[model samples]
Target: MTIAIAPIDPVGRAFFAGVVSGIDLRKPPTAAEVAAVHDGMDEFGVLVFHDQDIDDEQQLAFSRALGPLETATGDIAAPHERRVSMDLNDISNLDKNNKVVARDDRRRLFGLGNQLWHSDSSFKPVPAKYSILSARTIPPTGGNTEFADMRAAYDALDEATRREVHDLVCVHSQIFSRGILGFTDFTEEERAKWAPVRQRLVRRHPRTGRLSLYLSSHAGGIEGWPVPEARAFLRDLTEHATQRRFVYAHVWRPHDLVMWDNRVTMHRARRYDHTAVRDMRRTTLTNEVSSLDQAP
Candidate 1:
């Protein structure tokens, strides 16, 4: 199918591609070529490609052109593969997995917020810069991904709200969120390893310094506010940020490549028939880990 590129939404300034077929992502992209992709991505926040029938090496080349891939770690990261693959299909049983549940598994359901509205990894001290996903095997129906334009959301926010959030700090706790999901059993060692998570409500882009939304479902609450009040506040802000009118829906097809700026957008996974296989390979760009009380 011919590659048809389009904006992320009717009102979204960013753009995304809709693939009738797919694109070849195996071969290495030249510097000039990749520059064009980055240029569009900076303006649009997301750029979708179709029909990526490439091998692991080709995928690595394309991803490296964007940024260095984050280290492959945890259950979601692919140890054997050249790049990482985030597998939402298999939730971690950290006990048998013999890993620290203090962070990974507890934050598991937090990813469920992807079904809601959020900036990717916004709760981190140094939030994620970008994300790349390639459709390895997509289910016949459903599991469509939707992305919201946060830059637009930021622009859309009332001036008063923006000023209020300008200096606010919110604590982002994976363990706290895990506790909400009912995983309260933690050894002292685990607790010690995890301090309370927190991040600034607003972040400046490392390069352009353009402001972007900086909060997530993993965000337990705004720092130092009543629990109920913080929850209400965060919920309302996210709700307004991702109204249906500001979204771009992508129906996955095999060999599709989608890239988005983590700093400027929020995305969610739509419900799909779990009985069917919907596999995808993802690489999160290594970014400075964001933290408030924690260290990078």
Candidate 2:
């Protein structure tokens, strides 16, 4: 079946987000449907599908239909202690036993970093292409996910600012993002596992050929700049990119699935009640080439 795409904005002038309908994600998609989704993603950057109740296996299958999946890694939880498979990211506040994690749980603390804007898997040598997040359970209020349109954000930059960022390279690390929250209790192994990776500060979308600012909370330093200066500059760019005009806040419902191109967007989860369960599973699509390898 063919999918339908509609702009999320009321007057249909929004440049970055759309709602996709007319196809059920619980079943595998036809080639045409897959192509339509890709087209929608290239044009919209973010796509939201509502009321499709799909489980983990179905979500993984549908995600794979779009692109190769990235293996989940570097979360605060150890392998044996994780509640979900390594193939799927467990974006939840629940422990392995399906109980709400304790108030001071290390995993929960680490997860607080999600509140900061970031591109999924930016810390990896090969960053993610797309991220599909499925909401199984959502809080009655709050816990919304916010996406920033980096492409539009780039378009809004002044000529000099754009030129300044166009050729820059930055180093990204989960340790840096988590460190921002004052959670520095990383095991030595964890530190090594999440060592910083370099990425272009500006990226060209492969399909649309549009330039986008690749800003993320994971970005701690630029290649040649001093640490303090680089971080301050990154913070300024993030603030500008996530301005109210450039962002789309998604108030999630149960069984909603939302996907966004990591190359053109940055996203973050909002605050929710720790005592409540907010189970979100995500499948990340691996980029064939890293930002380092891509044309600026």
User: Against the hidden true structure, what lDDT does model 1 obtain?
Assistant: 0.62
> What does candidate 2's lDDT look like per residue over 23-139, in tens digits?
999899999999999999999999999998999899989999998998999588888888889999999999899999998999999999999999999999999998999999998
The residue-by-residue lDDT of candidate 1 on 130-182, one tens digit each, is 77777877767888888877666777788999998877888765456546546
CA shift at 170, candidate 2, in angstroms? 0.2
Query: What stretches of model 2 exceed 4 Å from their correct place?
Result: 10-13
TM-score of 2: 0.98
Candidate 2: residue 251 lDDT (0-100): 93
Task: Point out where model 1 deviates above 4 Å.
Answer: 1-24, 74-114, 176-195, 207-209, 289-296
lDDT of 2 at 190: 92
| Total residue pair clashes for candidate 2 | 0
